[model samples]
Target: MKAKNDAPLRSRQLIGYFVFSILLNGFGNGLTVAMNLGSALWTASAVNLAHALHLTLLTVLLAEGVAVVLFNALVLRRLEWRRIAGNFIFMIPFSFLVSWFAQLIGMTPLVALPLMWRVVLDLFGIVCTGVAVSIYQRLNVMLHPNDDLMQILRFHFLHGNAALAQPLSFVPPITLILICVLATRQAYALNIGTLFSLVAQGAIVGLADRVVFPQLKHRHLVV
Candidate 1:
């Protein structure tokens, strides 16, 4: 009789674990957008090209999400060579698509402005999202599917190298740059906005890591 009661309690505990993970991941994603909202809005207001930048960011995010889903279903499930290859391959086109859409959107009169400004905006967005994901993962909460896959791959290929963690940590931003370049043919240029955005995103990510995640950790510990 006690065993039967304990079984439900254990199941409930597992369910709670899943719920906490989803909530933490979702909150991290939401905070990332909030952190970058200023740059996005400023770009839209100050530059004619901001709208395209906005659309481009949205598209790339969507593409990344799709890639994550497809990889999980087709590759991760099978745990085959194709999964790793497909994941990396899809990322390249996804990057290109992001830049292409940003350019295409920038061409519209509504937000058509300088190409350089749009590039800065895109870079800022990428850096913020990457930082946010990293901090959120450190909370030891549920992970984004992509993050989980990367960790798994890291274990297999790198033999659990601790340094591999940081490399995987930086992969998102690197991929973002590749995507930005694929979409935009212009030479990379550094500007005030680019620097500021990177700093701002880093700051926000740091605060979230230092402040918010600790509280979350405590809550789980108490529970």
Candidate 2:
């Protein structure tokens, strides 16, 4: 029965997973941001930068994306245009979705909810992020530049240990966040949720890989 699925079907499944990731990732980020509990480290860095620099979230995100893409070239020790384009392509819809979801969800009354429920939402957001990341990272049809950087570090430097690569990959963004915090004299998103993401996102993705869309194997070639 499983063999009934063919190449085109698999292609569609990948596409479907890609779209689902974009939505889930966007919604998850929105929830985290609106909760003001915390966000994934990279995202928290972007959000803090945006607030400090008085720029839009999309602007900071794109700038960070480009920087990561270039840094990826440095890691690979060469340039790859297709991979760069794929990163940008994923950013477009993803950025818009995140902004929209944030605005929509932020306007709701959940902010007045109890601390317990807010914590639940924050954790759920983090899990959503981990799961979405698992989907696209496995699909490997394309990836967020930051995730690509993790892949580069994981396979190329860290001996394929995603657990180590995950936090290790945070060095750059974490540095940026530190600078932003000092310059701005405040931090917006660095709480339990961010801590969870920093430590456990890789594990969550690993878990999701064996569970969510279990049939989807990692297409771990170049792009």
Candidate 3:
């Protein structure tokens, strides 16, 4: 049997990995965003999109979720309202949590830390993001729009190669960021952390799949 089927992994199923992933993802992303040292590429893209459009992060995130859902349906050539509903379910509360966490952290002194320390914090946030993504993606139960897109590509298109699918799923954000830069002549949250995120997020998610939570595996999800 795969390690995913082991007794230990089964034990982990009782710990609510979904809930854990939500908090971890929210906190990691919020910290990086609030600090603005850099954040994951997609998050930065969303931030830039928000700035470009003069919208709240939550609004942009939710709107992006809807857009991706349609894109996903296009790719699959079918509209699965149940899957779309789940995407909304994931983004609505999760977006609120992300905003809340960023607001909370912005109020604290952590955002004003020295350059080197802030870099470290931002990098750590990236790592947390990778781990959080790994857990939830492997669980393959509930997922955000971008993540759902990743899963769609990984399984249906890429034949389960996450490293390939992960980066490919970033097209929307990359496009948005480009649009924002063209209009504003600058990008928000594009920095060292974002660079690292562009290169490392997929690999980190791949690594975390095996090391961070070896028991959890992609459950062969279908949308």
**lDDT of every predicted structure (CA atoms):** 0.41, 0.84, 0.84
* Candidate 3, 1-223: lDDT as tens digits: 1223223345456358888998999999998998898888778988998998899999987888888888989998988787788888898998898888889999999988899999999999999988998898887666888888887888788867778888888887888888899999987898899888888888888899889868666764642
Worst 10 residues of 3 by lDDT: 1-10
TM-score of 1: 0.39
Q: What does candidate 1's lDDT look like per residue over 155-180, in tens digits?
A: 44555343344344335544555455
TM-score: the better of candidates 2 and 3: 2
Itemize residue pairs with steric clashes in candidate 2: none
**For model 2, what is the alpha-carbon lDDT of residue 58?**
82
Q: By TM-score, highest first, what's the ranking?
A: 2, 3, 1
Query: What lDDT does candidate 1 reach at residue 170?
Result: 39
> All candidates' TM-scores?
0.39, 0.92, 0.91
Candidate 2: which stretches are off by over 4 Å? 1-9
RMSD per model, one decimal? 11.2, 4.0, 3.2
Q: Any idea how many clashes model 2 has?
A: 0
